[model samples]
Target: MEKKVQQYYRLKQKQKDIEKELAELRQDILNYCSEQETNETEIGRYKVKLVVQNRKEYDDAKLYETLSDPEVWRLLSKSDPAKVASLTKLNVISEDKIMHTYALKTVTLLQVDKK
Candidate 1:
């Protein structure tokens, strides 16, 4: 409804269009590189390269299970406030023990809606 909001939506639409075009071009480049059995393609002096990387990602739950160390679990795990509150109500955990664990935070967000 406002000028800034109108500009934001307009720019976002252009961004989505550009991103879609880029993705299509990237797929074409990747396909060309694969077909040529080369990692790069040259346009005059400029090169469009396809980089393949093997990234290492460890499963947190599996690693935690395998290690089975209380210290490790303490370091890796995060306390869910709702779960903690429910457990606290049942007398499973004390309020005093978890008193300083919670932190207060403020967050602001913008959401765009289509009408």
Candidate 2:
């Protein structure tokens, strides 16, 4: 195996072990915070928090039906930006036409480099 592959495999294994230990530590912290009647607590330099985030998922069919606007549907409906970019690269769609697309937001991904 190449050096990068070996490094990735080692880090991936460490990540799994860290995740397991993290879950256990998370539970312990949560239990302590709950018993103390608070959603946040300070431990050493880390201000641990059990934050509740609100996330909304809209259904495409129902949203389009109620709104009846093509522009609204484009923004609200679920889509894959990578697919949009792929189609654009293949000359299937114009970049100017997708300005209203909410899924056209910038994104970045991390992966192992190809040898």
Candidate 3:
């Protein structure tokens, strides 16, 4: 009877562990899905452009900088020699770095001068 009770307790403990693991997995999946949704929204609204021929590259730091930097709008407002040079040094825009874009779009917005 003692052996049976020990076995029952062991089974209960095992079940608890499994439940905890399952809950953790579910939370991880939920977090992943939430992150994906946020990324999609950002991609749609963000102004960073991209030009790609083959597989596109993703640069998280650059993206964050571009999105967060206050100078981003100023850069976009002008496409001049000095501005281009400055942005290149800042790595805000690069020929090699392509934003998340579709196949139809090829050219990224380097600068946008007022009309």
By lDDT, who's the top model here?
A: 1
What is the lDDT ranking, best to worst? 1, 2, 3
Worst 10 residues of 3 by lDDT: 104-113
- TM-score against truth, every candidate: 0.55, 0.50, 0.32
Tens-digit lDDT track of model 1 for 1-115: 6999999999999999999997787677666667898765575556666555432233445444543657635644644555546656886556665555555453222122232
lDDT of 3 by residue, 1-115 (tens): 9999999999999999999997786566445546665322222334322222343233444444544555664554533435544665788766444343112324221221232
RMSD values, in order shown: 15.5, 11.7, 19.1
TM-score of 3: 0.32
Clashes of 2: 0
Task: Judge candidate 2 against the unseen true structure and give its global Cα lDDT, from 0 to 1.
Answer: 0.57
- Residue 89 displacement in candidate 1 (angstroms): 41
Which pairs clash in model 1? none
Q: Which parts of model 3 have CA positions greater than 4 angstroms off?
A: 38-115
Task: Check candidate 2 and list the clashing pairs.
Answer: none
Model 2 misplaced regions, further than 4 Å:
43-46, 79-115
